[model samples]
Target: MFRFLITLTGLLGALGVGVAAWSSHGLPAFVPAEQLPLALERARAASLHHMLHTLALLGVALWCRQRPGLWLNLAGTLFTLGILGFAGGIYLLRIIAGINEGPLIYVVPLGGFCLMFGWLALIVAGWQDSGAPQKHD
Candidate 1:
């Protein structure tokens, strides 16, 4: 279980790094040579990062059976939701004007709060699991 968490975390960390690098350098290959940096930043941070983080949370959630793992996974999931709701809403509103999502943007803060609670739960679960005394038969 620990190994699984480590592996998923590593993947997320690696993805974050790759995204940072790509946003800094690789976007020009796809975008027109004339677009401003702000547009690119918005796309990379809110769009690309949102997608990557969502996938990372999903991967982590696959191992959510153990207590600590579940909390960590939940936290990751909430954070992913926050990104999708908050950043993603704005992205969609800007890029997909015809699709009326309405006041779903109001849910963004709730998602953010969930993300924070998830992290706190993860920390507490970790401490409880680690600090428990092992039983001997």
Candidate 2:
């Protein structure tokens, strides 16, 4: 699980950078001129969240290596889910027209909530690990 999380973090980080580049260079070609600004804004926002949460996942992965607790695992899982739902949903909404009012609209906020809860889980992990003995190499 630790190795998987680390690999996933690296993959997500690369994907986030690629998405940011595409948003800046390629998005304008796809969106109409009138709608380009809003589309770009949304894309950039998604990329930002994508990159930030990927970093958070990296932290959780490293923490798991040291402690390997339930809360850390939950944090990593929630961070991954949040990135997918929040960032991936925004990218989908921007690229696919006429889906604004669909059920996908709920995904972004749900993802945001997942991110918030992931942080809370991290706090719990730290609290639980505080009294535990440290493992040394």
Candidate 3:
């Protein structure tokens, strides 16, 4: 699971860079001149969020490698969920105009909540480890 999370970080990081490049260079060709600014702005926002969360997820994964606890797992899960749902949804909305998404749109904030809880859970896990035996392996 830890290894998977690390691999996921690489994937997300690469994707974020690719998206950023597209936003910087490729978007102007596809989107209309009038809407170019809007498209670039949204794409930049999504890319920034995606990259930031990728780093956060990477940190959780690395921490999990040593601690291997519930909170670590939860943090990694929530970060992934938040990245996919929150930033991912924002990116999609710009592309797909009128798709019937229904309650799926709510995933953004729900995912954000999950991320916040995940970090809080990590803090709890750290507290649980206070005065405990330390093992790097």
**Candidate number of the best TM-score:** 2
Which is the better candidate, 1 or 3, if ranked by lDDT? 3
What is the total number of backbone clashes in candidate 2? 0
Tens-digit lDDT track of model 1 for 46-105: 656455555645554543543334566566656656665655554454323323356755
Q: Give each model a TM-score.
A: 0.46, 0.92, 0.80
Ranking by TM-score: 2, 3, 1
**Would you list the C-alpha lDDT of every candidate in the order shown?**
0.54, 0.86, 0.75
List model 3 lDDT by residue over 46-125, tens digit each: 77778888998898888777767777778888888877876777666653342237776776677667667767877887
* Model 3 pairs whose backbones collide: none
In terms of lDDT, the poorest run of 10 residues in model 1 is 91-100
TM-score of model 1 (CA atoms): 0.46
Evaluate residue 61 in candidate 2 and report its C-alpha lDDT on the 0 to 100 scale: 88
Q: Report how far residue 125 has shifted in candidate 3, in Å.
A: 2.5
Itemize residue pairs with steric clashes in candidate 1.
none
**Against the correct fold, how does model 3 do in TM-score?**
0.80
Off by over 4 Å in 1: 33-35, 43-70, 76-114, 123-130, 133-137
